[model samples]
Target: MRSIITISREFGSGGREIGKKLADDLGIPFYDKELLEMASKESGICQELFVKNDESYTNSFLFSLVMGNYPVSADGRINPDMPLNHKIFLAQFETIKNIAKKGPCVIVGRCADYVLKNEPNIIDFFISGNTAEKKKRILERYDIEKNKAEDFIRKTDKRRASYYNYYTDMKWGEAKNYDLCINSSKTGVDGAIKLMKAYIEIKEANADK
Candidate 1:
């Protein structure tokens, strides 16, 4: 049914874990860092470079040129004159679209919600938590002292927001931007997934009617 789930998450909200579990439960492919690899392979760029520059803003023309926006030769290599970042952005954009076209899959981060905003079967969710809960999660996962967790969360979420804001017109973590704005601290990770599944099913049933 062309189900594409896009999850936008706060730092340490366990959204990635939820996405993986959801995909496993639904028996569908899950995409996260793997998307970067696929995009790199498809665009003929170095995988490490792709991951480094992936979703990263580029003001440099050279960076944009290597990314492949220029016309390709008969052999599919980008023309010599194009900016790398532009090329990479276009390639990644196309890759994301292609993945979505394949049907139901879970995509985490990378402004995927905005990418698939127009798709009828797409369900966009934003997972967030109270500051204390988020900090605790980060501290435990990274094995950091509690005092450092707040700063880490702030910096991480700021980077995510910057990345998302640069690529899309929508604001990151805005409730209105998503179909479901879940507070993971309240629902917990598994509960959030269950709620998301139920929400999707209800929406689909209503659409069918």
Candidate 2:
């Protein structure tokens, strides 16, 4: 009930839905796309840039070499010359920390688990589903052909994995990296949320003792 929850989810896995509902039921704030807006405002960067780079990282080594690392000078100010992608990430990193300071909330994706790794009251979850279930979910939510849904899901998950793996030392979807790994296909969204709530309650109670 008093933990900052971070959810890393596979494409079409109902992760965002679970995070929002969990926050609502717990009377805490939920952040997903809303984090992008806050990042834009905080960094004075265009919102479009954050959306474009959100949850996906650049894979080209040459491009990264040209852009250089996300740098902070001795004064602790981010270098003006840092790449746009890095800038967006830094913005999100700062925004996530700022949001956590406000209180317990559910944050979805964006390597939030890594960003807040050192912060207290952190609980991370990874949500995944079987390929068939994910494809069905994608087909229903998006106006795409049934034949293309599987490919779409595969590509989207690849991008997310690349993003997360690039940002954090831990592998995405790895069971050990998360406090709990839920297969939404088996339990469904409501069941997954219930499980998370139960886990958080137990964790909080143990902490108090």
lDDT per residue as tens, model 2, 1-209: 67999999999999999999999999999999999999999889999998988887874422232234445687878777877776767778779989999989999998888877877799999999999989988988999999999999999999998888876677999999999999999999999999999999998899899
TM-score of every candidate: 0.86, 0.92
Q: Which residue runs does candidate 2 get wrong by more than 4 Å? A: 59-70
lDDT over C-alpha atoms for residue 84 of model 2: 71
lDDT of 1 by residue, 97-204 (tens): 899988899999887887777799999999999998888888778988788889988888888887777766678988889999999999998999999989888888
Which candidate achieves the best TM-score against the true structure?
Answer: 2
Candidates in order have lDDT scores of 0.82, 0.87
Supply candidate 2's per-residue lDDT for 169. Answer: 72
Scanning candidate 1 in windows of ten residues, the lowest lDDT window is 60-69
